[model samples]
Target chain A: MTIPIDVETKHRIVVVLLWLAALVALAVLAFIIAVVLWNGLPAVTLSFLLESPRDMGRAGGIFPMVVSTVAVTLLAVIVAAPLGVGTAIYLTEYTSETALTRVIRFGAECLAGVPSIIFGLFGFIFFVIQLGMGWSVLSGGLTLAVMILPTVMRTAEEAIRAVPESFREASFSTGASRWQTVTQVVLPSALPGIVTGVILGVGRGVGETAAVIFTAGSSLHIPTSIFSPARTMAVHFYILAREGISMRHAYGTAAVLVILILAINTAANWLMLRFQAKQG
Target chain B: MTVARREKAIERALLVSALSAVSMLALIAAFILIEGAPVMLRHGISSFLAGTRWAPTKGSFGILPMIVASVVVTLGAMVIAVPLGLSCAVFLAEIAPRRAANFLRPAIQLLAGIPSVVYGFVGILFLVPLIRENLGGPGLSVLAAVVILGVMVLPTLIGIAEDAIEAVPRTYKEGALALGCTHAQAIRRVILPAARGGIIAAVILAMGRAVGETMAVIMVIGNAAIIPCSVLDPARTLTSNIALEMGYAAGDHQKALFATGVVLFAFIMVLNSIATMRIVRGRR
Candidate 1:
């Protein structure tokens, strides 16, 4: 099939060029990851992480940040999980694909697409101002809960949809009600996917800065309660960068943030894989 | 006294409340408007949209450069992201061997999980300096914003495009190859055309991500209100503008920040409508 200077070869060349371009982009991404890790890894020690920022500003440990991220993210998932999973149950089990379902679907899309800053703005006016939550962990968690609802809803919906029709038919043959089947059989089957959604939602909450900044009111100390003001690691990084804390805790904070992201992302991947394997 | 009765009540509740998702959405819109309307009303729409200077301290809360910066950053991100992301899609779907793809797929997606603020850090350390030295700038400009956004968006584009390409029928490739076309040629002509809708969806989704991205864009954008005549010039985007100013803002100034959010909200809602429309229409 060899031909002299074939057009097919020329086209293949272009495609290969595209492939190379993509590979190069990946390489660049890898380089960025490598450099950041290189700079960050060397600086992070156990003491760097164990000590709080208040040790005459010498201790670089992110105790407050780590605690705030965990606490706020916990509250966010607890809020979002029930609502999102409930909505998914409603859409998948109870409702028809009627105009209303269509409208809600559209609403979910809109809510998801709404920018973080807009979420922040709304949170500031409603939660921080009108309700006078006063830059507390509660406001940030609620705002992030709203922000992550669509993600959980969509995934949970998909999870429900992917459950086999035969399972329903099988249950019906045994005189089992639709509600019984959904709650007992379907929910269990879709639990992994639901968990995946919750984890990803929590991950987003942990890494979020912009939305929290407006609602949470940027406090540094560990909060005594949900209403207490606080700051997460991401916000701390923002402050460090904005306040010109250059070449100091900034790099370490950045590293901590990256590691947190990577941890969450890894968990998400593992869950997704588990979900697929379960389906298979 | 039956399961059906219980189901009926539950279903009714679900139906009524689900419809309220609309009002909830409208509530978000309403709140943004209600809270932000005072600023636009006070300053008039022209001054809010068209005013050049953004001295919130002096009651000059113009956001024209911020708007310009948002557009410039988004467009620049698209320039770098679209080609690379599409190619990556093409590679995974059309070029790479299946085993290799299976191994690498999750890793590729893992990039998406990297938090925006972390990406901001990477941009500040790596991209800001790179642009400063090579492009000849101080640091933290529209260029840095573009590079960060582009990198951040790559996973989205590739994921969407890969799914689209995978959905292309084997017959399309077979038909092209049957007519003396190579694998690449078949992909070029037939697979790509068939997957255009999905590719377009990917781009739109990426656009949505770009427009909404706040922490990362803010971290690297230098937060300058001046219109960027060059990529090297510092700029401020809509998201960054709000994030930067939402603190310590009160009165009309606070309302204007909310107004900025309303504008961003409107844009994102349009994008959301498109995504939903495509989904519903495509289903039929």
Candidate 2:
């Protein structure tokens, strides 16, 4: 028989391997953030943040793209938040497990799985062509609204379900209607979680490219209205890098995007932690 | 009576809002099929599905090469990602101290929050050049896409897989330890087997992410339409084909691009079905 390693030694070796794996996973994140910031941070400046692009994005700042990003993301959240919360309310408060609920859940799950590019295609045909919205902020925002809907719904559902059942019962014994109980008690307790979900949806909308590029129409011009075709920061970065327009500009844009996303994610995580602490 | 009437109206409104997801799904499928299906029918399904040539201007539209490239790059990514993700997940669930796991969990979700465009930019700056200098192929190849995607899918894989592993009852581990098993051996024999269904589900879900990935894959994959003979060779994927060509395409070319989207949607639906089924089975 082959010489066998002692159990304690073997266990130590495995633990070391697992530690290395976790370290490697974390390292990848650290390295990507470090590399992007290292190269891009110097390029970010006051003018770079405030001025519009010039020379087909070879020079000047990303002010227009910034505005477009905010406009589109805000519109998406405005459209999606109520619908998502309403869906969550319906699922958790108004119904129990049934065929209808199952169908709704299945539809939401399938929607979640559909890829962004397909959403692009659907938006292109339905909103851009059939509905005659064209490639504009309106179409792009609507498309992203649909894209982030499942995420919003799922998060809201979890938050609502986490509210104690006894709270609902107390409202009922006080002769509150189901709708009154949900609106007054359930939603208030779930507000932090719902806001977290909305923030997450905003984060996804901010960074989306493929779907936005098709529906939003990547114009360098600042959007004056929802009908205006304007580029977002993500789409602008994609075009610059892919077309090899200007590496410096691309890096600066990337830095901004990375920092913005990091902030949103941190905010969401903090809110979630606070919510959990309160629940406990 | 008035309160009851008001309550019923509110319930109806909420129910209508709840139907939005289902309606959106139906509309997306119907619209994509309406735009894409005709082109597929015109080309004959087999030619589009199995044809090798894909010159839109020349009236040739075959997507076999892109299909093959998507499958190969996705599978290659899974190969690189699965072991790394599983070990990290295991570390989080079992080996890591509570303080460390708490800090690290959010850190990984941050990884997912990084935009795909940024991932592509990073790949272009570092990974592509690295591959070119060392690996001998054009830096933008299937290999580059695989490496980038492997890292991209890690968050999804680790998050779900860790949940699955942690869901196994503590008694299973205690039983193994009581029977004179080492910690590593007990994990290998009992904990892992108990978590098998969830682990498999995690893999399938990650596979879906890898396949649906667009911006990063487009940047690094060189986007050549031909099938690659090796991972080092350049290739285009189904999503990229749509993204790259949809801008200037007209008429049938546009429809062909939509047809590509149809194919991608179908592939993802299949993956989603399998993952959901696995999750359901695991729960049972």
Candidate 3:
């Protein structure tokens, strides 16, 4: 097809427009991070990190929220990683292109597209009300695990598939069983990629607000057990901002959350790049 | 156990684990439907969907306004995000130097990782006041939601669209170039057409994400439960409707929220199917 504009001029204009688009995306990221950090970094003193909130989060620190964030994130990764990695192993190592694999893949793809709010609803009904787990870390963690399961499975599948068939063959050439070959050879080669997936899941679980809020129950107090309702930093930030309670505290919480997410994302990207480099 | 028996057991265990995604999807669908479907059945799907008022306290749960809000906001966001996201994807995949692409890729990933709540917080502080003063009406209108959600969906759109663009066969570009086409002409005519399926799939997936977002929408949507006459008018989404009320809602109110979830889930499933079809067709 021919264009009204000259090709060279159109190419130049389009390239400039594309560059501007990328700049806008970058500016958005920078603006969010800079604004949050500028408003929030002052609130992140040692006392702020160590002390519990007082006066409904208008005063004091986010000690309880920190503990809750760590506990919930850990629990989610613990539950999701094995199941996700195992699913990857099954799909890549034990199976070929088949109806069963396609069904499983479809299920995963659909799950990935399901919104966090739906996951929250499911967890609220199933784990919280039906199972009597209530709004607690357990409910939140389990819900998050389900939400991030697809990420883990997809990453692990990619990693496992990248492993050379010759490695498995070499292991099988020994007296090793199929299971042994997979466990020793394939999994070892895929470890970095699997770790990247787990880290990505961790970042997602940590940054989650909607699913965590309903299932975890945004309590300000430090959680005593898995069953104890607790507030994540993201939920805390949402509550503070929404209620117009404490803009300062909200910024502080947001800053901390942003910092954590940035660190986690950077780590995951680094690991993925390193893995890709190794594979290449 | 014999070695073969052990291997079989291990394979069985892995297979069971592999079934986790399917079972989880099944359980989620069943639970949401079980809790939400009764309300839809009781009220009749037509009245439930077509009704405008959402006074849960008074037992009226028409969600037409919220549905309209969701669709309008999603469409608005998509209008803003798709062109910019597609342009960025094309630039990165076809135009950018290798080092620049490598650096920007992670930055985009990090952008995606920024929690929705943070975006909402920023929106409340910045977009709300800016719109309130300049655009008139409530600052937390569908416009605010459109801007935030448009930004939120960018990473997903760009990432997938970039992959799609990159996946186009090199021979197609070469063939176009050999026809005395300029670099831009080769891409616009040959590469982009070949990448149409993936780009469409990406857009649909991003649309799903925008539709499902909650905390961010709630924070800035003004939550009036009214049909927006204009982009500047305050509106509520199905997601914000559920999230706002689920905390204090009980009895029928609670079920109504679940029913809202059912609607959202059904909408998302439709989007997912369309995107999946596009992806599958692209593969062929």
Candidate 4:
């Protein structure tokens, strides 16, 4: 109903001002990106990112952190995928229209609205303290697992729902058990979206701060096992910058985090496209 | 057959197992409160609410100004971000070309992915300097937090508000147009009101983000534990307070941080409930 900013008359000045503000935003976004890219890329050459954080500071690079991030993220996905997919499958395919399903759907939606800090608090108590995981990678990963459950469940549900009822009908006609049809047919159809959710959730945890900081000790020691204290790159950046580290170093770290996020997003998009093409 | 009846029970069991994700939120809440309650009970109500000095080492347990700062900063962010984010949403959904809208959508997503620390870095690097240069005096004030928080919440608000605006029925727009109403008029009159519930929910959610935000606000707010007399003054926020001091806090000081978290939790619970209410009503 509204005119595009360009063509709208009688408000040229307003549009100009809006663009100016947007440009400023863009500029800020760009400068930070550039700083991170400029610093991290050269410093994080293949070996540095590939290497372990067993040596010294500033120069040691973030190998263990990177490994832990990947390891924990994978572990998280592993934990979330079955339960999330099962829940999603039940919601979209198996369950009949009912109050319970409706309530569950609403709960899943609101789960994303909970602040990450609160999740950190939960993780600190449940995984880190009560469970005696004690700031281990296992606790961090499991906490992230629960945090990402709703994401995976919702996306998996949508993807499963997109598999037409005909598929189920045909499988039933072919004498396939409900579980067989669901596991074999519905899962393959929904795999792409489920994978996307996993990717997105990993991206979220990788960038997370308030939640992971408390549960995952910000120790820079290279984790000997999943239970060892470790620092995520995001948390590293927070601690370093908070302690008044030089802007260049902070910018470099931020840049590394951004690049990783961008890379994750790109892969997810590619997966989406490939999946859509297959559907077509 | 007994076998078939057992199979039915098994199906019901599977259903129960799958739907247990719904309980996870309550579980999370309960777990946090359980860990946090001891500290809250020990500190009593007065010092947690009425005091202001936050030295964990000295055993000073005042959090009044930090609580106020959190509220003020969140309010400032909401004041600036809500309108701007709404306008951006309007621009995308109602104003922009399809191509531009599609392009901007992903850019907003990109914005969302950039870490909060990066935003903090940008606040320190760019926003602080810009505010300092133009506005004069000590840089990185509450205004800076507002500016950064406004921009940070832009993508989230825009994405949600766009959905709300887009959810406005096509028939309403057509009817408005048929009545000699301009496209802009239809949007301003019908679409906005129709989408009011969702917009409010989106705004509330963004407010939540602003309140919980630590790294970015901590980066720019200067972390002064004073009652900010104006938006131009530096102030400490609740999340920033925790992140700053939780490092070395021992005993009651650490407990105070937990109490602060309890306060923040109560704040978020209120916001989330409001958001949930609006969202539920809109669905109805």
Candidate 5:
């Protein structure tokens, strides 16, 4: 069974295989991004961005969908940011490592693992139906808030934990209360990380499709209030593509979505890099 | 107000906010169970789990086909992704220069951040047509789901595997290299075995992701509630079934969808816990 293979040849083969694997991964990412941009960019016009849809998304723009997407994302951030930051603060600053902390961490992991469709189901039943929010921006935003809660909390916790212990000790030595130390000293230092988490949450909210579909009714018109039903760009693209309604509009919507997500992700990455630099 | 009282109040408030996360998890589970369990109990758990048919209109709620489809798709995705991901991880951790890794790492993270819907869109536009033209079948088969999910899970698998591989002490490789082993030989003989636990953990986590993926799978899996005879055969997954039907399902049918969710939830939980355990063990 001991065939004498040349070590040089074997090393060369392994290196080639590793290069091929990396190339394949890179190729796939490139192809997908290129295809989306190629097919989508032409459809994205000023009119498409500014005007409302006409004739069930076949003839006009996606202004309403854009508005709805922003509204829902803003609402989700409003609801999730404070709660997530507070939870992170509690975990990092207030609480000792205990069974309760373990349970909470476990819960966050479980939440993170739950599928988007399940969240949609829960949101439809609980927020839209049980709470009488009906398929509206509020219901959709609330559902998204729950879905993104773990991401924000985990990131914020890491950020808060990354704050130097010496900083806290300095504050304590000044006889400042724990609350004051966190709010005035630690939070200011950790703000970049927290903002990065929120931006990432916004990215999720924007790109999310399944979870928002049922809870946020796919209304054609722009939503005027939180109670008003509306469609997000992702849901709009899904409906258009799935129903074979309008590929042009779908591509246009997809292009906008892709751009929005890329922008948010780039900003988040920049903030994270800056935060890391500051830490170093 | 006294500073001590104010500090206590703030601590309590923060504690309550933190506990809300736990409560939310409990609430989701409780509601899903309460809504889903009745139908299962009424229909007999065995019948619900083991039956082949899943016609909600006809009042049959068996999910065997969906379960099989889910497992098949997840396994197929893992089979395709793990090698590529692992090799990529190895290249990044062991072979590539630091400059290459610095450039490649963000690219991989960006891949992860691209929404699932975009993946689904790409699948419908490209993969489905390609499959239909070349491989036959309805194009939107488990093959399409596998391909899309395979790509979707790559960043996850690669990132975790890279971390695990990098976590292997530099001394291990140094020792092997000192013995005159080639870089590849040392990595194959020493580094891989040292990082096996973490790689397995990565695979398990990716499996959880593949099993739970919905929107993309729904777009490409054809949504047929039948056991697939081959990868090219159209079939429905548990997540897809719930999503495709929850819109119009009523009464028993709706309850059946929730029951499906319960199954999916349980599957994810088991995979997640196993992955978590492996990761914890690997860290130690």
Candidate 6:
């Protein structure tokens, strides 16, 4: 198995190849971000950020899209956070190693793997058509809530599991009930992790285009209520780019969307790192 | 209330909340089946799945082209993504300096967090034009989708592959080196063999993502209903077909779209289960 001196070249070549591959990966990332910002940043202006569309989304800004995106994302968070945390608590704290628990975990995994487009179909059928919610923020948000529940639950479960056993034992010895210890002690320690999950959920909700499109109803008007049809930034970008209406505005919308996603990701990673540091 | 009774009530509430995910899954499966089954029964599942032409307006609903397109695009994406992603993972886990790996990890994550729509936008702006001008046919071809999807799946592949490689016991590498094997040889022969299960799982997971991707494919795949003969040929996938036609589709046409979802759902479920099985087996 010994390598001859001649094999030094082979090793060197392999090393160089590895470096090149790594560089290619990084370059793709850099190239994408640069191209998006270069094409998109110049089109962004105060009016572009604030004004309503003048002619079929060709002349004006994406103010309404932005509003709808926020509305839907916030609503999704409001609905998903409690359910996800409760599920996580049930799994980590209340449940034992039982068949039902395994089934629940598998169900969550399956739900997580289900495609966004399928979620869109479900939302369209179950929420919009069956439930009579119609195409609105409520329908879109509920769909997203379902889509993100597993992510939140998994992350929160991990965070809860990471809580030290001694902490729980001490709480119990001090006459704290299970509910009291969880609500007063365990939850406080797990807040950062739960927050991380919520942030990730928000990021998914904001970036979601396919799932929201059918449920939300891509109207151009500014929605005055949750029931009013509205378009998200991602959907607006899709419509503009697909129809060849205005590449300028499409790029502009894409740039804003990219910036928002990147910001959320950075913030989430930072929070995760801080939590890890505190725990360590 | 007594302490035991209070605890029981709380546990029951949490258990109910936990079961909501299971209920949601059941409801989704039921609704998709309920809505789509009638069409499949009426049209005959064979014709619905095997017929080539998809003229919903004229009452002919065939998804053979779409199914083929989905497989072809996903395979093409895997062809491009797997090698590059594996190499990147190898570089990070075995070759790169610790500082470089740390920096690259976050960058890769940022890549993952970027929305699919943005990838599609970039594809339409840059990739599509490049393909159209140089490669012939419309810019929005399978090649455009392949390139974009390859990049889109990189983070997933790299993240999982890196974990697998890193999980290989240090003893394996040490033993290889002690036998006078070069670092590259050690990695290729010893570390990689050890991590093969996890790597395959990662690839399968990435395949699942590629198959399930909708918006990006819809944006760049030209939305043509015909089967593609080449990488440059524009074709529609099951996902894109459903997304494109669902909005205006009514009655049988709508039911057909739901059936398409059932097909897609089955594919994803199988892929995910296989990948999860591999990972679990690898762990043991």
DockQ (Cα-based) for each candidate: 0.57, 0.82, 0.87, 0.43, 0.71, 0.70
- Model 6: residue B260 alpha-carbon error in angstroms: 0.8
- The fraction of reference interface contacts (C-alpha pairs within 8 A across chains A and B) present in each candidate is 0.61, 0.79, 0.85, 0.37, 0.67, 0.72
Candidate 1's error at B147, in angstroms?
A: 1.5
- Which residue pairs show backbone clashes in model 2? none
Where does candidate 2 chain A have its weakest 10-residue lDDT segment? A112-121
State the lDDT of candidate 1 residue by residue for A106-150, as single tens digits: 888788777778778777778887888988889988888888888
User: Positional deviation of B261 in candidate 1, in angstroms?
Assistant: 1.2
| Superposed Cα deviation of residue B232, candidate 1 (Å) | 1.3
Clashing pairs in 6: none
When only the first chain is scored, the TM-scores of the models are: 0.92, 0.98, 0.97, 0.85, 0.97, 0.95
Model 3 residue pairs with clashes = none
Tens digit per residue, CA lDDT, model 1, B1-284: 67779988767765664554456577779899998778887888899888999998899988899888988888889999998888889988988888767755766776776678778877877789888888887788998999888888888889888888988889888999999987777878899998888888788878889988998998888898999989898899988888887777777777788888877887777776776676556445
- Give lDDT tens digits, candidate 4, residues B171-282: 9889988997666667778888999999999999888888888788988998888778887789998888877776677767766777777778788878877887887788
Measured against the true structure, the TM-scores of the candidates, in listed sequence, are 0.94, 0.98, 0.98, 0.90, 0.97, 0.96
lDDT of 3 by residue, A8-96 (tens): 89889988888899889899999999999999999888898999999999999999999999999999999999999999999998889
On residues B1-284, what C-alpha lDDT tens digit does candidate 6 reach at each position? 99989999999999998998888988999999898888988998999899999999999988999999999998999999998999999999999999998788888877877788888887887899999999899888999999888988898899889999999999999999999999999989999999999999899889888988998988899999999999899999999999999889998899999999999988998998888778878877
Better DockQ candidate (2, 5): 2
- Model 5: residues with Cα > 4 Å off, grouped in runs: A1-4
lDDT of 6 at B161: 93
lDDT of 2 by residue, A1-280 (tens): 9889999999999999999998998999999999889989999999999999999899999999999999999999999999999999999999898999878887888888787888888888888989999999999999999999998999999999999999999999999999989989999999899999999999899989988999999999999999999899999999999999999999999999999999999999999999989888
Pick by lDDT: 3 or 6, better one: 3
Off by over 4 Å in 1: A1-5, A55-60, B12-23
